[model samples]
Target: MMILVFERVIVSLDLENGLYQEFSHPLYDYEPANRITLGVLRDCLCTFSSSEKFSDVWIMKEYGNVESWTKLLCVPQMGGCGCYIYTKPLYISEDDQVLTYFFKMGKFSLAVYDSIHDTLKIPAIQNNIHDLVPEAYLPEIYFESLISHFSQD
Candidate 1:
């Protein structure tokens, strides 16, 4: 299994035998090690890195292969939203649209990024709670289970 350690190095661990080896990607060379965020996209290991000017998303097309790392998306840091202090990719639609969560300057928002056209869109969401604090809210993806809740006899 692939795991990201504190120093921004990717480590492969063999849980069955308790052995692990560390590896580094060239993408980590240019960016600050602490700013890199590791995640999974399309069932593959992925990473998100950001700078003051842009944010990049990378996917490892083949597991355990350093050369298989491919840049999936690069989003420019645009106006209004300001530079993203934090970015988390939540989902990717069939049309190559990426649903991402971003937090900046005490506000959190969701944006849909179209890789085909290189565009970003913020969807309109209705907020019912007037006392909601942005810092108190955290967004996450929910996976539905196929197994029924009833006990098997």
Candidate 2:
């Protein structure tokens, strides 16, 4: 089982050997609200975050080795405005280099990060994304349940 010590830091337990190893960023002093997303892209372990001055995408070149961790990309927040926000990885391009992601502070539009070119492109009007808001499939309203489903008379 995998246990996430902090929001960004991941720790794994070896059941057979009863050994524990750090699988993510060593530093633990970060805001609890700050979120880091982990995924497997291009067959490599990757994590993305926008909690710092710049958005950083970290990739573990050789798994289980902290030294092998590398910052794949460090994107300046809001083009260097310094407003930190979360950026979630959506998918990897067919070439396995370009990464498509979504910025938590953006206008609900998809942004493509070309790691090879070290560039970011957001297709707003071209992609027909305007005033897009993330929400659940079903609209929800807070209310009290009048009956219990588990009670047997």
Candidate 3:
């Protein structure tokens, strides 16, 4: 059985070159059960589930590398790379407990590092991402929160 399940959320960058992609989820570690065994689907993207969410949902969009600085129309991005819309589902414990071990920002892009798999998942906005892999800043990520959102079926 597949342990991990994912959902896709989106962020749009208002830019010249508009493009987008859908983020992919891992094969394991996102199921409802007791004592989930951590498994690696790729060299990156890990966890008991990709179920960490703490943001306002929005439409997904893309932007260009260079922005109109003189006109002050576009805001500068961190990586300047286009990103994919992702919906990540989390694991609600049998005891009605929600565990969120990811990142979140007010309006800025959210990025995280999977220590178990050793990779960084950065949501790009420019259009230079060759492939999604764990990044060098993977060690800076931490567990966000653990709340209550479970069911006993």
Cα lDDT listed for each candidate: 0.71, 0.55, 0.28
- TM-scores for the candidates: 0.73, 0.53, 0.17
RMSD of 1: 7.1
Write the residue-wise lDDT of candidate 1 on 43-95 in tens digits: 77778887777777788887767788998777667655563654778887778
Q: Tens digits of per-residue lDDT for model 2 on 1-153? A: 997763445676665569977665734233425566666655566776655555666777777777877776655555542223545665566653443444445434456666667666665554253454443221122333322345496
- Model 1 earns a TM-score of 0.73
Clash pairs (backbone) in predicted model 1: none
Clashes of each: 0, 0, 24
Q: Please identify which of the two predictions, 2 or 3, would achieve the higher lDDT against the true structure.
A: 2
- If the candidates were sorted by their TM-score against the true structure, best first, what order would they fall in? 1, 2, 3
Off by over 4 Å in 3: 1-6, 9-16, 32-153
- For candidate 3, the 10 contiguous residues with the lowest summed lDDT are 68-77
Instruction: Tell me the deviation in Å of residue 140 in model 3.
Output: 4.2
lDDT of 3 by residue, 1-153 (tens): 779654532233323457553333223223323322232111222333222221111111212111210110111122223322222313222332222223223122344433344333554546322224423222222343221235457
Scored against the true structure, residue 1 in model 1 reaches a CA lDDT of 94
Give me the runs in candidate 1 sitting further than 4 Å from their true place: 1-7, 81-83, 127-131, 142-153
Candidate 2 residues lying further than 4 Å off, grouped into runs, are 1-8, 13-21, 26-33, 79-84, 92-98, 103-107, 115-119, 124-133, 137-153
Higher-scoring candidate on lDDT, 1 or 3? 1
Q: Judged by lDDT against the true structure, how good is candidate 2?
A: 0.55
